[model samples]
Target: MRLLAFALLSLWACGCAPALSTFQPAHVADKGHVQAELGLDVSVPTGAIASVVDAGVVLANIAESRELTEGERLTLFEAGGALALNPPSVTPHIGVGYTALDRWELNLRYTGSALRLGTRYQLLKRAKHGVDLTAGAGVGRYVIDLPVGSILGLVELEDFTRWQIDLPIQIGTAGTWYRVWGGPRLMFTTFDTALVVDLPAFTGYPGERELASFSGTGLYVGGQAGVALGYKHVFLGFELTLAEIFSSGELAVLGERAVAVDLDSFIIYPSIGLMLEF
Candidate 1:
């Protein structure tokens, strides 16, 4: 995915000069000017931890010894340990955003899906360089899982999703070429799960939907860098971001268990977008 993102961005960013320059058709470029920011932010994290999963797919594709065709039968167990290391999961995402900068220069941003909504206010803003602070919170569902074995019973894993809250604080520089930011966010959960052996049966466990569960929360810090170009009413930009998602939860299953499973992750995503400002 990182390879694909890099490739795609290179094409767009390289071809964007004229497009960026033409995006401010009505802007008179003066005091009390009002503008709106409408863009899509997509993040994809590909650090060492993520590579572990990606390499598994590459090796498996090679070992399969056959040309992999779309719609063809492909089984993880058949592919070997490589497939085992990777989980059947879709990346978490948020989209649909709108922002407005009033004549007084106050900025407001709203970004998220229907399941959750995140709103941020720029406590400070400056076109050249200045601090822009944001605070946001929302509710969502997640879970903690333990290893499965002959005993936690049928190891028939299930019941591991819970309601939760996400509170993130962000501080960045407001700029046209780029903006750099770093801050910590707090995560809190309504329930908790803990210690035991992670047996071979659950070595590649992503999560057992059937196992009733809860995950403890932790604090996280991350940063984002963004660049934009505009010509007339058309504008283009991209952002690279990374966040340390921390959550440590332990669990005992069947007759086995595991402790302090790294429920934390680092992710990156690059996105392209178009916006019209008034």
Candidate 2:
């Protein structure tokens, strides 16, 4: 039962973890110009307390059938990398971008746990000391997994997936040596999660069984800001983003009432990267 609680908490953490997106500049690259970047990201949760409370409730309900003592319930909640308020995690990312015809750009990025593809079209060129405009769209997919040991009797948490899409309008300026950009992004995401538990015949529950599963989708509006400095073919950049999510979803155990888990409404991301342009 303790192992089961730990597995549940791990799944919840993975589902709520943040994935960073690449910053898009308003100006497209020159034809045949290619850019590659490597970066690290940190997500600061502004509403982490709410997320923790939600997870705690879900875990408590799961243990209700086992008649856990209050102390055991507390311990269960704290085990297996339990959700923490304001605890931040770091992830590394890599991306490659290309420009075609000096007017169109495409970028593909991976952030360890997520994959993103984006495209942009230059709508208007920048005048001297003025801003340029670009419109673009992005799609991303993410997967999260948590595997408990076979010694624990075949408890596996896998196949937690999320898909996201966004449309952004960028307004910014680019000069020979520097660039600054900001944009408003409209986005949506959907999730599918599963938890599988298999105990040995000696443990009473002998067969494999799914403990919990859920699906949900959310819509969000966000803003991003970025700045970069270029010297020759090498550039360095930093990006910051904040978003609010309006989400609706319910988690369903095989034989229990569906539990509603409202996702965190506020999210923040900060990242820095080194880029090479050729």
lDDT digits (tens) for residues 121-217 of candidate 1: 4454454344565555555443223123111111122333334465555555433434344455354443343222122223344322222222444
lDDT (tens digit, per residue) of candidate 2 on 1-278: 54454345434443244454456566777788976888876655546434454454555455534444444333322221112221234557888889976778888887756778888888888874366988988898774442222111223345666788878788898767777888885888787655444422333333334455556777767888899898756778898878776666655556464456555557677878886777
Positional deviation of residue 217's Cα in model 1 after best superposition, in angstroms: 3.0
Clashing pairs in 2: none
Candidate with maximal TM-score: 2
TM-score for all models, in order of appearance: 0.44, 0.72
By summed lDDT, which 10 consecutive residues of candidate 2 come out lowest?
A: 78-87
Query: lDDT for each of the candidates?
Result: 0.35, 0.61
lDDT of 2 at 156: 35
